[model samples]
Target: MIPTKLIPRTAEASEPPLLIKSLLAQSLKYEPQREIVYRDLFRMNYVEFNQRVRRLANVLAELGVKPGDTVAVLDWDSHRYLECFFGVTSAGAILHTVNVRLSPAQILYTMNHAEDKVVLIHEDFLPILTAIKDQLTTVDKFVVLSDKVYGETAPDVLSGIADYFSGEYEALLKEASSDYDFPDFDENTWATTFYTTGTTGNPKGVYFSHRQLFMHTMGLLTYIIGYEAMPFKGSTDVYMPITPMFHVHAWGFPFLATMMSAKQVYPGRYEPELLLKLLIKEGVTLSHCVPTILNMLVSSPAAQKFRDNLSRWKVLIGGSALTKGLAQAATDLGITVMSGYGMSETAPVMAVGYLNEQEQQLPKEDQLELRTRAGRISPFIEMRLMDDEGNFVPHDGHSLGEIVARGPWLTQGYYNDPERGAELWKGGWLHTGDVASISPDYWVMIADRTKDVIKTGGEWVSSLDMENILSQVEGVAESAVIGLPDARWGERPHALIVQKPGYNLTAEAIKSGLKDQVERGELHKWYVPDRILFVPEIPKTSVGKIDKKRIRSEMKEQILTS
Candidate 1:
């Protein structure tokens, strides 16, 4: 280690701990009047939101929550959920944002694994809790979250679990005192915990420290708002998160938006119509989501009707690769769309699309190509590509390697799993498991997931590349590519496609389209799928990513038989 001089600190100097409450305090100081809307149900300004957050902290304390305890919340994107984001962590308890889309068994496993002491569950998710209430060993209390009044009686789902009920969310907050001192602690304390939507076995738990989250928020603000040529977000922009808050804190936007004091809208559950309505009604200028949600919104009839209203909207696409076809579709509708890249363990944002001065002057088609890539890495992130032999791959934009990263905000390791955690951080760098080539200028173009890349005839074929090509084909609504086991080639590319309504697409037409790509040198001839199966829908993971694992398992026998 290089020796460095240390500065002497005065005894009276104060070093404030970087905590979630600090973000809330900034919002309170700057934009106390800015509103937070929850699905047309509740609307409150920052001052009131702060009171509610404080009340929630008090409520947790009254329910016997102690420092280092876990509080799990199962709800849609709502004001209540936002309150929990600040409140639970401010009180020195870890907030577990349960993925409500998981199956009952998985939900039970995650809640129990987190060792939840208090659960604040939405009425919509009560059935899920009801299914696993008997099996939960650590939960000490349950608080209901709902839009409508339960009146004198609780929902039928909570019939047998009345004793566990503390009270409803709003009622408890209303009853509790809105004054609580949020004490300062070590900045490295675990603040939030959530499990990844793993394709195999159980979802691994990942937690973030208050310091990590604070640094992530600052880094994102610097890159996204302060540095980008066409910034996706601003303090003046009205924000709505199309992504589920349960997933990586909606890619950590809630905290950033709060720190910026931007007006926020939370759609209850993602109904495309409702989302569009909120987009129109709230004048939502900035948002983020996976490509699947964007496809759903653009495909909806309401999108066309409200096309003019969406002209000012800017969306950052992540959770999966953003295809050129999807980006063009949104662009055609006058929506600004860009791609970002990160995973559940990365605090979900390591890189995002950024157009430099020269790149901004490029032609539309060239710009779209650049915008759909993973783009340049964010500030404070040290990223490099590493090969199988543990050698560093050059950033020449042609060498392929697995993307490994080290950053202040990246999860140190998986929660409570020392064995797997060691593997995750093997070389002191967090392995991202994404295969990509980085341009000399630092732009990242993702090829495919490490496990999802297809090996055919000794050549590596990127499923994501094939999917992106297929997405641009006429009449194709959605597509997914997987490697099918074969005797001759070892593995062959196979595709499942969902066609756009009113268009009948055949395998021959799709193959012809791939032939065009091959001729243009955009794809290899071997990259064409041996079989194309038109399907009603492609299975997606709980977080709306293409469930290629499920697809591969389901299609293997079917393709072999066929």
Candidate 2:
């Protein structure tokens, strides 16, 4: 647990503190020759990267981006995006990341909700902004992010903007101040804001303070050190964040890279084929993305060509549970896959499945199992599972409860949305809404989501458990379990399955295959899915998560029609 001391002590006169500005200052000192590579551009040293960031800050100030004002970036993961990550924070502005996958309506809702003053959007996403421009309330200027992808902006895309600027983002760095004093930024000042995917309701905005982000960056150093087998050198490694920049700060990789002076690689638009090619050509040592993205990479026909490169890659999987099947497939092809868990509220990194000194002695199989569960909490995070009454659950591997967490990095409240914020921080704990069980070793097995758990005959059934088991079937590629409306019981399990290509499957066959578990007491009779529907594809949310809400909605429509 972190001490109650909220303020970090200032370093002695001879030494500076480990703030982001100091980190950049020091990187230029030691790693001056290290390369920082993006998809279409590259810089050879920290001096270049640092200067560019400072220039961006100066440009932002010139454009009337005041302290504490929200500056939203709607762009792909590019060199400019990474620069904005540091430049925006250094300028004392909050960087709000708009998920490009969101529909125009949702994009408008989030922008209006955050009160973003300036939107720095990629020229490619212009169509989306055009659709929602009439609905936005807070945007005062439009700064277009130009790249090689869109050589020149379309005439209609640039129309009706209050102020618009286009050209290279790196140019701002050259023309602006190289040595202006960084503000005496308060740690509590907002650094970044992100909108939740909003499965249950409209997307809610959550922002993190500079102190929280700084702490998270420091904590991840241990996690990278644990990746020694496929080592990452602050100089030698090239990073391409497969995760979107807007999503949990791309799981804090950008912050960690800046702190450690690591070279970065950005995959502008994630095409598994393109990513695979970049992984090999660039010799990427460290990367972070969700399981589904890796699924596409490994399953892609191009995977075999990059066999040598795949074995040397180190990956951290989060955003959703990574099943054993996906892990094994990655492992078989030489990829090191580790599970990490966090919510949109926890600056999003609570635990990573990196082996500590003690766990190094565990057998390979034991280590893999440990890596599969959300590994133990990081040094800065405190986590516990508590029952509905708030009593702590024993870490006996069988006792189950909702997982709750509190840490400096956790969100204090939803941005200006008091009612939802209260619900998020109820009982003084950041409610994860994830139900799980913990082992004596402190590993967490998330059994089901609180809202997704099926209650039948006054007992709970873990949809995750059923889905995990079903996904292991030879013909099933992916599976989702959701509670369907039932008359006899409050709710019953219904399975939505996607089968592997060329495999014939039926609901009866799938049900019979799972019956052995009930006979063996691995599962109870009531836990089985009452109906199994085979679909060509499983519906996924913008973030590549199973869309159970959509499934349930479709099922309801089917029921009404019948």
Leading candidate by lDDT: 1
Off by over 4 Å in 2: 1-18, 40-44, 149-157, 160-177, 226-236, 356-366, 560-562
- Candidate 1: where is the Cα deviation over 4 Å? 150-157, 229-235, 516-522
Q: Please give the range of 10 consecutive residues that has the lowest summed lDDT in model 2.
A: 148-157
- Among residues 3 or more apart in sequence or in different chains, the pairs in candidate 2 whose N, CA or C atoms overlap within 3 Å are 239-265
| Model 1 RMSD in angstroms | 1.6
**Residue range 445-505, candidate 1, lDDT tens digits:** 9999999999999999999988988898889999999998889999999999999999988
Q: List the residue pairs that clash in candidate 1.
A: none
How many clashes (backbone N, Cα, C below 3 Å) per candidate? 0, 1
Compute the lDDT of residue 557 as modeled in candidate 1: 79
TM per candidate: 0.97, 0.91
Best by TM-score: 1
Query: What's the residue-level lDDT of 165 in candidate 2?
Result: 45
Compared with the true structure, what per-residue lDDT tens digits does model 2 show for residues 467-527?
7678678877777889987899999998888877789999988788678878988778876
